[model samples]
Target: MEGGGGGGQELSTDNVKGIVLALLSSGFIGASFIIKKKGLRRAAVASGIRAGVGGYSYLLEPLWWVGMITMIVGEVANFVAYAFAPAVLVTPLGALSIIVSAGTFYPE
Candidate 1:
């Protein structure tokens, strides 16, 4: 598909880099979610209160903090990818990332 108002511009090297970055972002984000869940579970076990039940104990978990930082880095990577590539190319990669993450880590 041709991009709008660009005289049929094709994908460039930067677009390739963007795609790679987006994929890496997806991986990091997916892993971070898993890590954060583990931290939440640990916090709940230690405090005898689930985060869903208004527990703030997870905030003190170092693993949770690491996961949050991983997510932030992922987001930053995604943002940079967008800057280097078109939305049409980037959006599908994001969706694929979510699908892959779900398929890889989804509970039965």
Candidate 2:
């Protein structure tokens, strides 16, 4: 907790915590999607199946499962962030994940 010697609120400790948590949530979820996509691509190449074409081969992929678990953890952080801040703040921050995902893309 940070203290303001002057008698005015500079951002309470909860809000600061919420902001950090929200950012972490967005980053994790964004990176997770990219990872999941890569995993699916690898699985498809190995199994002669494409998830986009309704293939379930990703279910057998450990990388895909890792991405899934990462996504779940990110979602948990997002939910916890909501507990410390208003949705007005958290919802807009959620868009950072889209930015993160876009940055993570490659033309491969």
Which has the greatest TM-score? 2
* Tens digits of lDDT, candidate 1, 1-108: 645776776769999999998998888888788878888988998999999989999999999999899889988988999998888887778765566456665342
Off by over 4 Å in 2: 1-9
lDDT of 2 by residue, 10-70 (tens): 6678888888889999998998998899899889999897998989999999999998998
Backbone clash count, each prediction separately? 0, 0
Top candidate, metric lDDT: 2
Output the worst ten-in-a-row residue range by lDDT, candidate 2.
Answer: 1-10
TM-score of 1: 0.82
TM-score of 2: 0.88
